[model samples]
Target chain A: MTATDTAARMLDRGVTPERYARGWHCAGLADAFRDGKPHAIETFGAKLVVFQAANGEFGVLDGYCRHMGGDLTQGEVKGDELACPFHDWRWGTDGRCKQIPYARRVPLRARTQRYETVVRNGQLLFWHDPEGSPADHDLLPPELPGVGTDEYTEWFWETVPIKGSHCRELIDNVVDMAHFYYVHFAFPTSFRNVFEGTRATQFMESKGRPDKAADAGGYGDADMVLTSEATYYGPAYMINWLEVDYKGFVTEVVLINCHLPTGPDSFTLQYGITVKKPEGLDDKTAQYIAKKYAEMFGTGFLQDVHIWQNKAPVQNPLLCEEDGPVYQLRRWYEQFYVDVADIAPDMVARFEFEVDTTKANEFWHEEVAENLRRRDAASEADAPLEGAGH
Target chain B: MASFVPTSEETLADQRLYTAGWLTSVSCQDCLAVVGVQKNSAHHTSIQWSAEALAACPEMGRRPRELHAGCPRLQASIEQAVRAGQVPIGAGDGF
Candidate 1:
C-alpha cells in the first residue's frame, strides 16, 4: 500500500503509536536511581537505562550496548562509566565509547543513544524526541516547599497499568469540566482553562459531598470549596495542585502523574503524592497529617482507573458548551502528534482563554506563568534562524 | 613598541595585512559579503553566522536550477570553503 493508504489503515485500526512532544518524561522518583547502579525504564517502546554518575548526575541511554547488543543495566559501573556485561566495552556518560578491551583503538563513531535527563521536584525526568532533536526548553517541576527535606515527608507513589488505553484520553480529562459533576460527583462553582503551545492549565473550583472528598482527604460532611489547578509540561506529564477549604481548616496536596505508553494500546500511569506540613503544628502531628493526605489523594486518583480502562477511543467527541473546552484541549494536544514543522502555525491558532485566578493561589497561576516566560525565552534563543539567503 | 631598523640598504618593506589567529574573519569572494566571523582563545572559541548570508549566496541552488538560477562557479567556491574547515553558506535549511 502507499504511504497515505498505510497511514489511514493504521489510524482506522488504532494501532499507531501516538507521537509524543519533545520534553521530559518522568523516569521515576529522583531517589530511586541509586549511585553506581543502572535502572531499566520503558517509554515509547524504547528500553532506556537510567544511571547515576559518580558525580551525582543522572543520565538515560539506550538500554542495549552498542557493541553486540548486550544489556547495559546488567553491566558493571566504575565511577562515571559503564562496562558492557558481554564484552566489557566501557561507555561514558555522554554515550561515547571510552575503552574497548583487546582492541588497539576505539572506533570514533562507537556510541549509543543518550537521552537528556533532569531532576526537578524530587522526580527524575527523561527527555525524548523521535528525530533526535535536542531539548529546546526545560521542564520546571512545581516549586513545592519541604520537598526532599527532613522537615517534610517523602513522596508516596503508585503505578496503575491500564490495558488498551492511550495517554490522549487521560489528557482529555483535563478539559472535561462537566464530568466533575456527573462522573466524579464534583459540584463545579467556577472553571476555566488556558492553553499555550506545549503548556496548558486547568483551574477548577468546586463543591463535592464527603463521599467524593473522602478519597481526597476532604471532610465529606462539611461543604468545602475545593480549588484545583493542573499544569501540563507535555502530553505525558502533568502536575496538579489541589486545595481544600472548609470550616476554617485548609489542606493542600500536589499530585504528579506521568503516563508512559508501553505499547500501541497500553500504558502505565505513575502517580505520586506529596503534602505540605502546616505551620505551628508539631512534628508528629504534621507528619501524621501529611501521611493521611497522601493516602487520601492516592485513593481518589485510583477511582478513575476503572473508567479509563474500559473507555473507547473517541477521536472527535460531540462536545457541548458545558463540556468545557474539550475541543480546544484536543487542538493543543494535536500539535504534539503532528509534524514538528506544523507546531509554529498550530501554536498561532491555539485557543486563548481568560483564566480566573481569584479563588486560586499564586501556586496555581503565578508560578506557571513565570515558568512559561523562562521557557519561551529559552526556546527563542535556541530556535533555528529562518530567512531567505538574500 | 620598539622596532629594529633595517640593517641592509637593499631591504624591501613588505606590505601585507596580518590578522591575529584568534580573530579570523571570512567573507564570500563572489559577492564580497561577510560570511563568518569568530573569536577564539586558548581555551574557548565562539562563532556566529547569519542565515541570510547563506540564502543570499549567489550560487545556493542546484545546478541548472528550475526554481532559481545560480552561478556554478560560486557553488564550487562554497564546496571548497566547506572542505577547508570554514563555514559554508547554504540558502535554506530545506525545511
Candidate 2:
C-alpha cells in the first residue's frame, strides 16, 4: 500500500490511540541494574518506575501503588520481585502478585498495573505514542562506539524539575543552531555560520565573532552535525540527532538530554555526560563530569527552560513553513498529547540511569581558538587588498 | 493570534464542542469557534462556568456573547438579554 494509505490506516480511530503529545517516549531511565531496585522516570506528564529482578530480568510498573498510592521504591527488594511496604502485598515485574502475607494465598485479582515494555539499544523503550500500537516503532539514536562501557566510563544521574512541556523545548533545542552562538555567550564568538547538509541536516559552521584587537587564527577544528526526522514513536517529539567530533581536545565533554513527566505543566530532563576517565580521576568523577556539562551545556539550557516555563502552559504552536521540523513534530505529538485511545496507566516506571560526566572543559578552549583563527583569516582577506592593481 | 469568530451562520442546533492541546472550540452547524486554553485547567475549571469566566477565556472573549462556558443557562441569559456581556478575556490587552 502507498504511504498515504498506510498513514491513514495507522491513524484510523479504534485501531490505536495517541495520548500525551506523543504516544510514547524514552527517557533513558537506566543503563543497567535491577533487583526490585526501582528507577523512577518522569516525562511528558507521566511517571514510571522499572524494577530490576535479581536474576537480571525485570518488569515495568506504575511508580505509585494501587493500595494507598505508596511509593513502591522504598519497599523491600526480594529475589526477583518487590513487596509493597504498606501491606506486604508482593508483586513481580509482570505486575502480578506472587504472594499475599495477609491472604490465604495469592488472589487471582491481586496484580499491580503493568505496561508493554521492550529493552532496546541499551535503553528501555516504552510506547507513548497515542495509539500505543506496534506500528509505532522504537526510537533510538544511531549506535555509536563505547555506548555502554564501564571501563572508561562511570555514571550518575540527577533529575531536575522543569516547568514546561518537553516536546516544544526539545524540538526547539535540537533544531536550533543560531542559539549556540548567541545564547552561549560564555564562548568567544557571538555568531556562527551554517553549513546546511540538506533540508534537515546541517554540519559545521562558517564565521563567528571576530576579534580585531588580538592576534588571530590560533584555533583548531570543532564540528557538529544536526539531523532531524519524524519517527513512528510520536509526532510531536522530533527524532533528532547531534554528533560532535571533538578530536582529542578536551578531558571530558558531552551533550545529552532526555525528557520525562513530572506534572502536567512540567517535565524532567535526564542527561548523561559521556566522559573519558582522566588519568588521576577521583572517586567523585561523576560529579566532576556533571559539573562540567552543567557549566557548559546546561547553562544555555537553563535559559531555554526559563522561556519554556513562562510560555502558555499548553501545547506550543508552530507553523511548518517557519519552524523547520515543527510540522512533523507537531503531527507526531498530537497523537500522544491529544488522542486518548492510546492512554496506558501501567507504563510508569522507577528510572535510575547512568551518566558519565568526567570529561574536562578543553573543548571550550579549542572553540575559542577556532573562532580566533576564523577571525584572523577573514580580517587578512578583508584588510588592505593592495590597492587592487589600479 | 487570529481574530477569529464563528461565522454568523453557526448555531447551537448544528454542532458541539471539542478540545485540542491548547485549543477549545464550539462547532455549530455552520462554523467552529475556537479558543486557546491551558488543558490542565480542566481538572478544576471545566467546560462549565459563569458568563464572566467564559468572557475571560482566550479567543473565547473575541465574541464573549457567544461563549456560554458550556452552561445553557448562561447562554440563555445573555441570549435573552437577562445578562450583559463585558470586555473580552485573555487578550492580555484591554479592548
Candidate 3:
C-alpha cells in the first residue's frame, strides 16, 4: 500500500495482462461418438465434455463445469440435460443449469457452464480462450478430409502429456520430415520435402496461424514437405495437422494437439488420430484400420509419452540440422507469450487440401511391399478361418 | 464346442477374433483371445504386443520393463475398485 506501489498496482489492474487467447486446441474429432462414445481424456489441464446434439453433431466442451468448479463429463446426460453428479443439477447445451429436480423452484443464481463447440473436419472443437465466444472468433480449423463426417473409424490415442509451452520446437518435431530417417529412424536416409511447388529448406516462422507464415518472403525460404500444418496463438494451445497416408484407401486425418504456457517449462500434448474407412466396407475392415493405426502411431506415441514426462519443456541446445527450422521458429512462439498481445489475425484464412490419394506403390517399390507382404503372411500362418464361429 | 479361426501371416487379420462365443467378457476374453489368436503360431506373444500389425506381424520390439511392470498395489486397488462396481472417479470410495 505505499504510494509508488499503489501506482504500479493501479497500472497493472484491468490491463488484461497479455493472457492467452483461447480458441481451438484439439482438432475437431472428439465428440459424441457413435456406438462407442467419447471417453474421458485424463489430463489435468482440460476437462473433455462430449455432447451429441439431436442431429448427431457432437460438441466436445473443454470440461470446465461452470458451476462450482464441477466437471461437465461427470454429469449424467439426460435427454437434454447433463445432471451434475454433485448436486443432481441439470444443464442443457446452452450452458444453463436449467432444472434442479430436487429443488422447489429454479434458483435465481443457477447457471450451468457451457462452451461453444464447432466440428470442422472430424475433431470436435471448443474455443478454449475462457473469454471469447466461438461466434466472436473463427471457430474453424485448417481443413482436412473426413473431418465433417462421423462415419469414419478412429484409433485410440495414447494420452502422453508433456509439461511446457508447446511452441515451435514441438511443431517442428512433426514438420521436419527428415527426422524420420535418423531421429525416429524409420527410413535409412532423409527424403526431399516439398512446399508450395518448391523444395522447402528451413521452417518459415511458426508464429502466426500455422498456415500463415510470418517470414513468408524471407531472404531464403526453408524446404519442408509437410504431411500436416500447425498453428498457435498467445498461450492458448498449439495444433499440428498430419494427414495419414493410407495409400488412398480412405480418408485419414492425424493431429498433434497440446496446451501452452505450461508454467515456463512444462506442457502436455494429447495426440488423436482419425481414419475413414472405404465405402461399403464391413465392420471387419473398419476394425482393421483402427488396429493398424494403433500399431503404426501407438508405438511412437508411447515412446514420446515416456520421454517427455521425464524431459524438460524447453531445449538444452544440442540440436542437429535435421531439427526443423526451429532457430527462428522458437523465437516466434516466445513472441506470442512475451512480446505480442492484443494482436489479432490479419485476415481470415481458409485451409482446405485434398487428402493424398496416391496408393502405396512405386516409391514404396516392390521389395519393400514384398517384404511387408511376406511378414504379414508368416504372422497369419494359423489365423482363424472366416465364419468359423465367433 | 467354441470355434477358433486359423489365420496365417499372409492374410493376417487386425482383429484377433475371440470365438469363445458367450465367453467374451473381461474374465475369459483375454486368456481365450490369446490362445485362439496364437493357435500354435510362432508369434504367440506378437498378438499380445502389436496386435495391430497386418500382412505379416513382426517380432515385438524391445519394451521398457516398467511399461508392463504392473504394480501389485495398483493392481489390488484396481481390482478392488472393479469389484466395488463403477464409482465416480473422484469419489472417495476407499480407492
lDDT of each: 0.60, 0.40, 0.37
Q: Residues A58-169, candidate 1, lDDT per residue (tens digit)?
A: 8788999988999998887867888889999988878888889889999999989997777788888777777687765544555667667765556877777777777766
Cα lDDT tens digits, model 3, A1-390, are 333322532121111123433444553345335323323543224446666644455545546555566666666666665665677776666666678788888767665444566655555555554444344243344465554356666545544445533333354453343333223323212222111100111212211111111212111111212244444432334344444333233334454354433332344455555556657878577667666555545554544445445643333222222333232232223333232243222111111111111221233334444744675687777443222111
For A125-243, candidate 2 gives per-residue lDDT tens digits of 55554344442443433343553564334434444677645444554443343344444332222111111101112222222223311221111112211221211223322222223
lDDT of 2 at B70: 41
Task: Output the TM-score of candidate 2.
Answer: 0.50
Candidate 2 regions off by >4 Å? A1-18, A21-24, A27-36, A39-47, A67-69, A117-125, A129-142, A150-152, A155-158, A164-166, A185-254, A275-294, A313-325, A338-390, B1-95
Which model scores highest in TM-score? 1
Which runs of model 1 end up more than 4 angstroms from their true locations?
A1-18, A142-146, A210-224, A348-350, A353-390, B1-95
TM-score of each: 0.66, 0.50, 0.46
- Give the worst 10-residue stretch by lDDT in candidate 1 chain A: A5-14
Superposed on the true interface residues, model 1 gives a C-alpha RMSD in angstroms of 32.0
Better lDDT candidate (2, 3): 2
